[model samples]
Every structure is written in C-alpha cells, then in structure tokens.
Target: MPPLNSTNNTESENVYNCPPIKHVPFPRSTSYYLQSEITDEFLQFAFSFLAASFQFLHLYRTVWWLPDTHMHQTVNFHLIDKSVALFLLILLSRRFWYSICITCVDLMVTKKRLYRMRLVLRYVFFFVITILLGICCVDIYFKHNNRVVYMCYPIIVYVIIFHFNIEPFLRTVYEGDMIYINGSPLHCCSTNPSAIRTEIDSLKKDFNNRFKQVIFTTLFNAYYGSVIPCFFVQNFVFYDIWITTFHMAFVLVGGFTTSTMFCLPANYCDVMHRAALHLGGWTRIDHRVASPATPWSKTTVWPNGSVVKYSGDFYRSHGLTTTAIPSNSYDNKFYMFFQNPAHIYTILSLIQVVIIVTQLFVLYFATEWHQMLSLGFLVLCNYFTLFKMIRDFFLTQRIYESESNIYARNLSN
Candidate 1:
C-alpha cells in the first residue's frame, strides 16, 4: 500500500511540475487547401492542348462563320461564342473560387469579420466586371455594327486598366506580411532546410506547365481571331481586320509580359542558396595555391578551431541546404528558354516594336475615314503595349544587374 501511495505521489508531483501547455495558434499565412492536384507532366500537357484546341475552334468560328445575311445578324447569342466565353469565364474564375473557399475556411477558423467582408467586396467586384464584359460581348456580336463595337472598346479598355492598376493595392490589403517563397508558405518554425527548395521546384514546374498553356491559348486565339478571320470574310473590311488585330496584340502583350514575372522562383532559389552558405559560415577567398584570384574558392572555420576548405557539395551533405540552386543547365528545355528574364523581355520588346512598325506601315495605305480611325486606334493601343513592355524590360534588367553586383561584391570581400 505504501509503495503504491508513493508511486501515485510521484506521478502527481511530475504532473504538477510539468510546464504549462502552450497553445500555439495555427499559422494564418499557410493555406491548407490551396494546392494544385494535377502534378503529372503528360497530363498537364494534354490539358493544355485541349484548352488551346477549344480556344482556336471558338475564335475560328467567330471569324469565319458570320451570318450570311443582315436578317440573321439580329440574333444576339451564338452557341459557339457563348460556350467559349463560358469556358474562359470558368478558367479565370478558378482563382476567385479558390480565394472564396480559402476565405470561408479562414473565417471559420479565425473568426475574422473584416477580412471576410473585404473578400466579399472583391467577389462582388469580380462578378460586376464579368457581367459588364458579357454584356459588351453580346452587343458586339448581335449588332455587327462596327461603330457600336468601336464604342464598346472603351469599356473593355477601362476594365483592363482598372484590373492592372488596382492589383498592387489589393495585394497590399489582402496578403499583408505573409512570406510566400515562390507561391508557397514559408513556415516560421520549420527546421528542414530542404523543404522550401522542394516546394520551389514543384512550383517552378507547375508554373512552367501553366506558362505553356497560356502561350498556346494566346497564340491560337490571336491567329484564329485576327488573321484567319480577315482571310475568310467576304467583304474584307479593313476595320474588322484592324479591330481583331488590336485584340490579338492585346492578348499577346498581356500573356508574354505576365510570363516574364515567373523568373522570380529562380531569383528566390539564388537567395536561398546564398543564405545557406552564409549560415554555414562559408566565405569566398582568393586561393593563392591554386590560382592568385580563384573566385570560386571558399573557406570556413569550424567551431573546434579547424580551418576547412569550402565545397558546396560538402556543405549540402551536412543538411544545411539542397539542390535548389539555380544554374545555367536545366533538364527541361522549356525551363531553359524561360530561365533568363532579361533576355526574354528583350526579345519580347523587339517583337512588340516590329508589330508596331508593321501596323504603322499598314496605316499609311488606309484610304477610307473609318479605316484611318480604326488604324489610328490600333496604333495607339500598340504604342501603349510597347511602352509597357519597355518599362517591364528596364525593371527586369535593373533587378538582374543589382543582383549581379551584390554577388560580385560578396566574392570580392
């Protein structure tokens, strides 16, 4: 009885002496449900091909299959146009649905009313814009009046401008200080150094797949919507050609410019690699024995007073880092093409310049007043797109130059 009593007392004492349980709040920044399910490379490619086919078919029909008589022009909705628009709406709405789901889940967990309200407002705004766009499409399709179509262009322009201009403000309000390393959460208490690297690689691959999808859709839409339409039309109105060309240029510019932003994952990899080296206490130093100024040679001092030659492989093996480091060589050919933001932007800017010059030359031959007006409008839109591309190029160039200078300075020191 005494032994049993003593054991009980010890157990009680241990329980009383134990540290109070700390209730660590769940991480608000980390999303539990926001992840891509389609990971297979071949599946991704197949899906992209399917989407491109659908877009091409829709654009081809819109351009080539116009009503044979003015009597049929009274019809407001076509089956093909409505179907294509619905598909595109669904495609774009995926992000919105994801956001709403996330917010609802977050509201249940965090009980934050302000954030929920903000998201609700954003949802309303999206629906309003979508409805407005749908109305514009209906008007343009039904009337077949070039004047009405030209007037509707301003509304489309306003929507695009509003969307792009308000994005930065919206991001600041919505995301706050959440640290996302390549579109994935970086947990504050995570001990595994390789976790972020793995996530980044996955994200990069996903982004590359998505980029291909966008490029295919844009190019197909542009070709079928603009150039192919002109060839098929009986009247061959220069105004129709110019309007479609404007839309094609808009789509191409927006798609390619957005793609250049994906290089951020590579930049993030470089940063993580450098941080790992710094944490491992490795410092670049000139190697007198090998060559007087061997920039790649590095050294580090152990805690036990041992001087060790630094090797990236050796440090990585100690679990300080992983193979997330960006290099010139890539296994995927698509990755290689997109690896350099500056080069991509440079090429894109040149393409934009060529498109603008070609349009201007075409404009000089316009004889009719409406044709001149349409051509002038197209030129203006092209100029705006060109200016945007140039701005993005300079920004990208500056970022790379700054990073290079920082790395060079680190090597020198």
Candidate 2:
C-alpha cells in the first residue's frame, strides 16, 4: 500500500509538471541541388545533349551501310540501315521516354502503383531492346564487308552489354541516394525506423553486387579500350578523317562515362562510411571482421529512455562527395581495391595517357588537318580523365589517412 501510494504520488507530480517527450527528427535536405550545386534542369540538359551527340555519331556512321553509288540511293531504306536506325531511334528515344515516365511516377501515380509500374516497365524495355539488339547484330554481321559495319559492330556490342548491365549499374551509382532523399520525412513527421533500416540493408547488397559487376564489365570489355586503336590497326582510311576522329571521340567519351559511373557507387559507400565514423558510431578495425555501418550506430541511449538520432550534418556530409572506404572490410577483393584506389587509378591513368600520347604522336607526324584536330580533342579528353582520376585518388587517400588516424587514436585510448 505504501509502494502504491508513493508510485501514485510520483506519477501525479510528474503528470502535473512534465510533458511527454516527442521525437523531433532532423530535417533531411530535399534539394536535388544537394548532390550537385547545379540545378537538376541543367544536369538533365547536359545528359540529353551528350546522349544525342554520341548517338548521332553512331547514326552518321550507319549511313555508310547505304550503297556508295548514286543509283542505290533512290531506293527506300536498306535493311541494315533501317534496322540500325530503328535500334538507334529506340536507344536515343529511351532517355526522354524515361524522363517522362519518371515524371509521371512522381506526379500522377500512387506509391503502390509506381513500384509495380517500374518493375513492369523495366522488364518490358529490356525484352524489347534484347529483341532489337539481336536483330541488329545479325543484320550488321551479314553486312560485314562494310568497314562501317566492322567498326560499328563493336559499338553495337558495347551498347548491348551496357544496356543489360545498366539497371544494376544505376542502382548502385545513384538510386540509393535518390531513395534516401525521397523517403526522408519532414522533421515533424515520424517514420518507421525498421523499414528504413531494412531498405538500407537491401540497398547495401544491391550496391555490392552491382559495383562488382561494373568492375568486371570494365575489365573484361576489351573492345572499349581498343576501339580507337582498331581504326589505325585496320588501316581503314576515311575520306573525312574529321568524321572518323569524331566517331572515335564518341567512343572515347562513352568509355570515360563508363569509368566515371564505376566511381560513383564506390564514392557513395565511402561517404556513408565516413559519415558513420564522424557521428561516432562506427569503428575502424582489421578487415578479417567487419560490421555494417549504419546511422543508428551513433544513437545515444539517454537516462530517460530516449535515443538520440543521427544529426543533419552526417547526412549532408555524405551527399555530393567523391572517393570511398570499402563498406565490407571482410571482402578481401574490395578491401584491396579500397586500400589503394590510388594505385589502381594510377595504372588506369598511365595506360590511357600512353594510348593518348601514342595517338597524338602519330597524328602529329601526319600532315593532315583532321589528324591535328583529332590530336587536340584527344589531349583535351585525356587531360580531363587525368584530372578527374588524380583528384579522386587524392581524395580517397585522405579518407584512408583520416580513418587510420581515427583507429590509431582509439587504440592509444
């Protein structure tokens, strides 16, 4: 009876004096500009322009499939040209179509329907492209006598492979951040922490698998590295070397984009890892045993039975960053890769630099104006690659050094 009386007294006193503790979550930055200071419209325009420019070069090359003679020009579209054109049209139309679909999903559709529609659209598009790809491959192979077909066959193959792999590639490189930004609730609203945690775990697995695929694809796809050189090897001189140079430049641009895509996912992972460390939840340890880094790691259990959530600074720090620490330290392959991104980067840069220098030297020795112009373009593109790679390399090294310092400090404690 005394205990009951004391409990009642305490409850009545507290009820009169205190209010319930309400969770006020940190407001997540909703600005797409968070990732790039540039506006989304600008980014979209840049992407559309690049896509059109590159595909237009491929289209221009396909024109060669038409018979060189004037008499043949009077006929309707040739089978090879028609097929390649249809494929290119399908390819080129995809980005705009995708943008429309995304806009519809965001503005006009319900969440449940949006998810189902995305799955349906993904599989349907893949099935359609696969059929078109096969047809194009057969048509192009049958017309192998055309040097344009020979040169462009490799390009077709590159497209097919990239198409099949693109979903996974994009999921890793950008979708996680997109999902995080989109799912974020207003500060006053509450979300299901468990649901967020589950989604993040799924994202981690998806990212790991997709990132591995990107690495494998980049390494195994020899034609990507060899495309520009093959023109020289075949000794196939074109009437307009400028066109040829542009065509090859298109391929170089594609390779550069692919290389850039590979880096994005890795950088995202590193950003999250750093965020975890900064929030004081994650610890650096030897790679034999590694735990998943999560925002909840920083959660502080308070005396009053409340938990402190991760801060806005943690989320902001992770956005729009470059370089990465491998998330799964236990993964020997990834551990080695992350341990020295600089070394791997240097090797890739030197190989590309050598290739560019060789081509430049050859172009220089040739007195043709087109060759000289090609030399300038090659230098410009290669220099961009060099700058990007070196910058990322140093950034990664800094991440590693900071991590090492953190671990050392902890050990000394």
Candidate 3:
C-alpha cells in the first residue's frame, strides 16, 4: 500500500527461512510444508490412500484367504501386500510429478493449479472413506437416551480393529489438531480421562515459559478432547474410557471459530493483542500471555515425511510465517478456509458446544453415576478447550509475524 518499499527488518529476517525456535519445538509429524515434495497434498493423500488400502487388503487376505495359516509370512497376505505396494508406488510417482510442478512454477500459477488438484483429491478420498464409514455410522447413529452421552460417525470412523486399517491413513493427512475452538475440537483423537487431566491443570502453567506450548497444544487437545468423550462413554468409573471425540471432518476442514475476542497480540508479551489488525477486526483480544519459548531444541531426527522446505518469506504478504521457518502444524488450514468448507465447522462447533454443554449440565442432575461422568467430562472438556484456545491464540501470533515479513518485502522492493 505504501511505496511497497516499506519494511520491518528485525521481524523480516527472523521470518524468512528462519531458524527453529531455540526454546520451543513442536511435533514434526503434523504440519505440511509448502516447499516440501512429500508435503504436497497429492503426495500425502496418495500415501494415505495406499496405506489405508494396504491395511484392509492385508486384513482381507489374513482373515479370508489364510485364516488358519499360522506362519510368519503367507503367500496370500504377501501377495496382497505386494499388490498394494505396487499401487502405492504408482500413486507416489503421480504425486512426485505434482510436487515437481509446485517446485518450478510461480506460486500464483502453482497455487491455483495445485489447489484444484488438492480439492479433487480431498473429496475423492473423503468420499471413499465416507462410503466405507457410512455403513458403520448408520448402525451407530442414535439418539441419546436422556443421557448426555452420544456418538457420531466421525467418532467411530477410526474406533475399531477396522480402525487399524484407517487410522494410519487418517493420521497421516490430519494436520487439524492445533486449531481447536473453545468448545468443539476441529480434529479428533483417541484418549481417556487420566489422560484428559494431564493437559488441563498442569499444562499452561507448566508451559508458561515454553513456546513448546504450541507443539504440545494439539497433544493436550488430543489428550483431553479424546479423553473427555471417553469418560462420557465409560461412566467415569474404573471403567475403560474408550475415546473417539473430535470430528475428523471438522479437523479436516475446520471445527469452530471462536470470536477473535481471545486472539493474542502479534508481539510476545504479557499484554492484550489486537483481535486482528488485518481481517477488519472481526476478532478482538483482552488478556495477553507471554510468548512461550519454543521447546524441543534438541537436535533430534525427524521422520522422512516431515522434512519440508518452504521459503516462508515468500508468502509474507498472505499473513503466514516467515521467521519461524516451515514446521508442522497439527492444525490443517488447506482443507478448510481455502476450500469450500470454509467456516461451516465454526458454526457447527458453536452449536455443538452449546448443545453438549447444556445437555451435560442437565445430565449432572439426572443421575449420580452420570454425575461422576460429568465430573470427568468437565475436566476433559475444560482442558481441551484450553488447549484449543492456546492453539488459536498462538496461530494468530504466527500470522502477524508472517504479515510483518511481507510488510518488509514490500518496503524493500
């Protein structure tokens, strides 16, 4: 807007191809790097689909073809494995070509093209999985018996032995963990109560000085989001709390979008930040938290799939990270705001949270056993909400830093 030469040097250098935070480190497994060959949506989905198919394929062979063959390796299953591997190889090749396309083309060209390709791929796989899950969900989708507990397809999608066949595939492409709402989770996880409590009372306070908070933000969300629903199902006794809360689709697209009321400021300090200086102030902030230092600075090895290279500086104008270098964000945005899904998830979550919270309170007086259930659910719910809030707040901080980078580039030119 200015002469395009206006820049913020200090923030600029830190944003582009920047070093990892010396203090805070997050899970390398979750984020998608724009520059990484494997991180491309096509490549990722290819692998996920293949992985999913391989799972059920082998399962088919073992259960149907070689049920009683107690051997280390069997011809039937191996054949199935080989077939899947071949398919995987082909798909990977397809993605490899696409990744190359992203590498050489201008971002404007690349993004436009790649975005379409990704949408096509997203729907294709989602449809396939949905078809397979629809059968199971139909069997389970039921009304709550005046009891606050309930289950949905998203919850059961990855919940069984059959889940083994789907989970790896689902988890591989799922980067939606960090972007949770105050009530409903954007993504899903499998956890229990004891696990739920871990993130709540101890996390923020313990993580006050560590930006590792971001890394573990999803961890806590998963830990508790999953755990809370689990407690609801188990009645909170010495019961086995099998959890499958989070709405994967929401996670895939977007769950809920709380008001910018709690958005954090761009700078890392103990003061309230502007809800959004860029997005027409639809968001706002009052309290401020210090920039938790990035943890996981140890020189640790990462999965081959996690290594992504993006010149974050290039995307500064779009309000993305430049100083942070590209890392994993369990919060996947590609499938959400950019696509047709938009913020339907935000509205869904708000509705879900209100409904669930009220129903939960009503259940409080319904039965004492459920009262125990409510206690557990309460702990898990609050904890996950906190985790989601933390994720959203810090994510905004990142956006601001990225904006700063773009602001600098505009100035220099």
TM-score of each: 0.40, 0.47, 0.23
Clash counts for all predictions: 0, 0, 25
Encode model 3's per-residue lDDT on 155-210: one tens digit a residue. Answer: 34334322334322332222222333321122211122122222222322222312
Instruction: List where candidate 2 sits over 4 angstroms from the true fold.
Output: 1-86, 92-100, 127-208, 211-266, 269-330, 339-352
Please list the C-alpha lDDT of all candidates, in the order they appear.
Answer: 0.39, 0.40, 0.30
List candidate 3 stretches off by more than 4 Å.
1-38, 41-50, 61-70, 78-93, 101-393, 397-413
TM-score of 2: 0.47
Task: Summarize candidate 2's per-residue lDDT along 144-239 as a digit string, tens digits.
Answer: 445435435544444554555556422323353334443221111112222323333444454565455455334322232323233322234224
Per-residue CA lDDT of model 1 for 1-413, tens digit only, reads 00111222343443343222121232223321222222222222233333333333323333223556444432223333443344344433433454454456555755567666666756666666567656755654564545334333333443543344433212211232336543433433222224433443544454444444445434433443333333323342223444455545644554343333322223432333233321222222334422222112211111211122334222111112122222212322222343335565577678778766776776687654444554565466457556655655665566556654654454344
Clashing pairs in 1: none
Error of 1 at 124 (Å): 14
How many collisions between residues are there in candidate 3? 25
Which candidate has the top score in lDDT?
Answer: 2
Error of 3 at 44 (Å): 1.2
Candidate rank order under TM-score = 2, 1, 3
Ranking by lDDT: 2, 1, 3
Q: Model 3: how far is 105 from its true place, Å?
A: 7.5
Cα RMSD of all models vs. native, in order, equals 16.2, 12.5, 21.2
